[model samples]
Target: MWFFIQAALYDNNITFSTLGPPKFIDRQEVPNVPLNAPKPVIGLDASTKVATDAFDDLEPEMIYLPLSAYSHYRLRGRSQNYPLLYEYFDINPYSGKLETSRRVSDLSMLEIVTGSMRPLHTGDFVGLSLKLVYFFFGILLSMMIFSGMMIWTKRTYKSTQTLLSRSTKAPSKTTKPEPSV
Candidate 1:
């Protein structure tokens, strides 16, 4: 059908969102600052050491996706092309520390660039499949009910006509010879 062809070939117009830091504008924006900025100060002092009681009032950032090699991001480090993504905490709350670190390290070591372009996942497939299955089943059920009702009404009308004919013909058979005399 024309509708099906259009639906199958139509652009889904999928929207993708990224949780990483914004792009850096310039290298010499700040005086005495390296081109690659340091990690966010998470209760750390000037010596790059964690400050006392820093975690007592930890305000975590909001993260939606699971931490993975695809989500690991980094900047160029001192004497290195890019700092390890594990230098920062995984923004995802559900991620285990070891798993998060491992994913970050794997991405950084292999120099893989990851972003929102990761292919649509299993959840998307499952959801679409369910929607289509339910839609077809609903259409089939509606058609079946409609055809069944039509057939039932037709059979009922034929039965009523047969009953009326039998009752009317029985009386004519009993009054046979009265007109002959």
Candidate 2:
């Protein structure tokens, strides 16, 4: 939950990257991009124009960027107030037109590393490890919940039985006073 909500509650933009350097950053590869290439994928401003490719518009200090948003490449963007996220685009290669863009998030790491263990996606041996991990997680969670409930129920039942037995106990004649009208 913390990791899930942290993206929203906290404006922690991934400024520094440790993945590696971009494919082509040297010599300023000014792409012949469309004016409407840069779109707001996550936190980028809509008014942000392409301005002769995104690489040219970036700050001098900011050069290196990760690859493929769909495959775990998150690059920071320039913003005035809040932290901004960049959407890396795929080029048509032939026509040099922007094909599509995707927001690079941490979840992409899973796909890159394990390729997901959800059985419905990967092969028998490829994602089987992740599938087993998820299965164990579910079993562990169920066991924890069941054990907690059992403990609570036992404590409650014992307490109730003790009180009931005490109340239902037969009283001695001397201790048994006359009933009030």
Candidate 3:
């Protein structure tokens, strides 16, 4: 549990850093940038336009995607109005579009699980490599935990046996043969 929590926090930090500071813009102020523009302004205000170019300036190895909203709704066994909702977003690398409209239950477990490791639509060597690293790391962690538990159980059993043997013998030797009948 501790390891899981730590891993989760670490991933969250990496994601936060990759996305950078949030730059919220009113929907009305958004610029009409062409989808194919080399550097499109994703957000804009009265004074200046914040171009998608800003993301390019980030560390070359960092994986970043623009802000997206995702919604997942499942009726489950409940009434129509009681559906569960989960939200998230992903980017379209080709068109540079932020696709946020999705229902959580509509996605398969694999899609939801792998979404963070790489881009959904595009496959690249770097993304594959990163995913492999994560897979191996999880396996390694599980092995380490199993080995540690085995060691602990072995030591505990040995100590318990030693203690029982000593206790059983100590009483026999310490009690003077009860007064002879």
Which lDDT values do the candidates have, in the order given? 0.36, 0.42, 0.42
lDDT tens per residue, model 3, 1-181: 5346547977787332223343433444344557776534332221011112222221122224434322111111111231222233333332334433234455666444544343322322334676677678779999999999999999999999999998988855466676876
Q: Model 2: which ten-residue window has the lowest total lDDT?
A: 43-52
TM-score of each: 0.28, 0.34, 0.31
Sliding window of 10 residues with minimal summed lDDT for model 3: 70-79
Q: Write the per-residue lDDT of candidate 2 for residues 89-148, one digit (tens) a residue.
A: 433322233334333343255332332232333223224586687678779999999999
Model 1 is weakest, by summed lDDT over 10 consecutive residues, at 43-52
lDDT of 1 by residue, 19-125 (tens): 34533213332234365865232221211112112222222222233233233222111112222121233321112211222232334322233221121211222
Write the number of the candidate with greater TM-score, choosing between 1 and 3: 3
Candidate 2 off by > 4 Å: 4-7, 10-89, 93-126, 170-181
**TM-score order of candidates, top first:** 2, 3, 1
Top model number, TM-score = 2
